[model samples]
Target: MSSASRRRPWDVHRLPSAEGSTFLVTGGNAGIGYFTAEQLAATGAHVVLGSRDRAKADTAMASIRSRVPDAHLSHLPLDLADLASLKSVADRLDLDHLDAVVHNAGVALDDPPRRETGDGHELMFGTNHLGHFALTQWLAPLLSAAPAGRVVTVGSFAARSERLDLDDLQSTLDYRPKRTYGRSKLAQMSFGFELDRRLRAINSTVLSVVAHPGGALDSLTPSRPPVSVTTAAERLRALPAALLVQGKDAGARPVVRAVLDPEVRGGQLWGPRVFGLRGTPRCEPVPAHMADAEVAARLWAASGELTGTDPDLGFR
Candidate 1:
């Protein structure tokens, strides 16, 4: 493998011109999502920042425009935890063509209290996996209309730590904050690769790929949103991690690579080349559990049932 560097082959600076492409990034209001939008907008892609809060979405677009003065930017309010909100947002998009959708929004709460989404599913699983699943379902037509459009779902390296319980997809059987987060991410990866397989089987042009922002932290991340300021205690906790962590800018590379890298194919997973923590983007191996066909099928069916939205392959 090649060495990671300030200017690797997959560096965002080398990103090809996306002048005519349009990308919608979920959770674009902050963190890795924001940086992904910023980089894409800087590369001349028309970027729509998707968030639950309009104010935050506006602020995020403003921040991006400050750096990329000529950026083509927009915002669409989307609360992934709520199925109704997802439908409303999809209706508003009304796009006939979209180059890509970055499924980056996730429940970022640390040790969040046990909770459920509007539809009564576990919050993390509902938001991270099912929400994107439904959103992708609604937007499949628009994506298929585009020339070689792709869906890049942002997964997590933390997923490698845990296997999912398909029988208890919602974690109702045994709920632990950290473990639930990992399972939700694993579900996201499963859905992404499985979607790719189904799309291929159906001869659909749209592609699905997964990428992870390995070990990126807000503390070391520059241009962080004002609302994202870390407290003293938070900073203290991240001190050790700071040694291995990269900023959001660097972390966003894998995702950007997955989205726009012409050589990349559907079902490929990308992540940091070194230590799976901090480095340039490279095609990484999918976790064994994440690639399980039976698990993916079960999760897909469960997700459709939970969200009340089935995957539409743009078929009539």
Candidate 2:
């Protein structure tokens, strides 16, 4: 695996031009998502930032523009936590076809009291997993035809050790902040692979790929001005941990590769190469949990039931 990775070639500085493609990135206003948007802008793609905060979206766009003066950009007002508003968000997109969507936006709260979204599901599960699941259903029609479009679901390395509690997916039975967040991402990763399976079963052209930004630290991230600023103190603190992780920008590479790589196939997992923690993007093995068809099918049914509406995947 290490030898093949060293032989596999990819240059982060010279991404192929996407030209006319249009991509919508959830939570594109900050962190890894912001860096992903900024990097994609240089490819000449029409990059749209989706978030509930209009002010932050505006700032993120400006930050990208500061570096790439002619970058095409826009914004979509979206609150994934609110399932009721997704259809309207899709309607407002006003595009005949969308080239790609990076499912990177998520909520990871560390505090004690477990929270819930507007729809009354656990906050992390709702916003991180079910929210994207529901949004994908709404966005299905807008995906490009002929050559097919893509959906890159950004998971986390944290999900590797986590498994969904089939009977209590929302952690209603027990909620530990870190574990709950991990399970939510695990659910999201499961959905991505399962969606690919269903799409292939029906011979659909839409591609679904999964990826995770290993360990990304804000302190290691570069300055994006109004969007983000990495302080010197934070950099000093990160020094002790530099070998094990990377900056948010570096972390976004796997997602970018998943989004734009022409040779990449559906169901592939793209992630950091070295130690699966920090390095350039490379294809990695899909962990056992993510590859479990039986479990994923069950989760799919549960998600379809919980989400309360469906778009045509081959199964249903």
Candidate 3:
């Protein structure tokens, strides 16, 4: 809990050499996802950008190519808000194996009054948690095929403030947009930890880890009118606050570290190690309650019911 300068003395400039590896990063077209893809592609890895918008994806890919002329990159359509879209992308993905899968796609719709997705679940919960749940489940075979694959699920410190309501997971009972967003993130974090447990139980080699940008002060969350406007302005006006907010490059560090670091253990949480929630990357501990077995099992069951997908797949 002590706050100190956690900056690594190592040269952060040298790009991660993921040559000979393949990676699929959801929402890799912009913001933190874009930077993550750019860094990975710079290392000669075969990077596929999973994006919902084709035009935006193409633009992001083009921008990356402009910077790193030799970046081995491509784009694939993936809309986390729609299960059908996720299934389609999963079906079309031809990779026999993947070194890492970065579950970076997420949304934070603050429209209020509880909006439901096409799947009829709360928009934020459905897109951020259930979508990734199904996507990861679908990609299990490919991940298992790798020598030692890694699944990096992006979460947020906002999760710390979340208290999952099992009875009304979709926020149907009492939907506060921001609270629901935090709750959904908590679910994602819980899923990451729980998935690691299940993976080990099944004797799978795929490593499951979670990471957060601390408070990057970026637009990682979906924009919704006043809440978005006010939040953005507050973030911008607070320059000292930005000191706690890592840049996209630095923000992407925990994900990279969790995904690529051989020392990273399954179920570990990585984030900045300073106040304002910004600093060099370091492994941190999630709350004990977040890893509660009963809560995870319940959430897993609820997710399966919502998405119509099985959580337990025999992958020994």
Instruction: List pairs with backbone clashes in candidate 1.
Output: none
- After TM-score superposition, the amount by which residue 118's alpha carbon in candidate 2 deviates from its true location, in angstroms, is 1.2
Q: Give each model's clash number.
A: 0, 0, 0
RMSD of model 2 against the true structure: 3.1
Give the winner by TM-score: 1 or 2: 2
Candidate 2 lDDT over residue span 78-111, tens digit each: 8989988987866898888888989999999898
Q: How well is each residue in 1-316 modelled by candidate 1, as lDDT tens digits?
A: 4344543465567788889899999999888999999899988989999998998888888888888999999988788888876666656987778899999999844675788987898999989988899888778778888998899999998999889887888878788898999889989999899998898888888889999999898766664556366667766777787667787778999999988888799999999878888888999888788889888888887777777785453432
Could you tell me every candidate's TM-score relative to the true structure?
0.91, 0.95, 0.88
Per TM-score, the best of the predicted structures is 2
The predicted structure with the larger lDDT, 2 or 3, is: 2
Give stretches of model 2 more than 4 Å off.
Answer: 1-8, 144-146, 311-316
TM-score of 1: 0.91
Q: What is the C-alpha local distance difference test score of candidate 3?
A: 0.80
Best by lDDT: 2
Candidate 1 positional error at 217, Å: 1.2
| Model 3: residue 69 alpha-carbon error in angstroms | 1.7
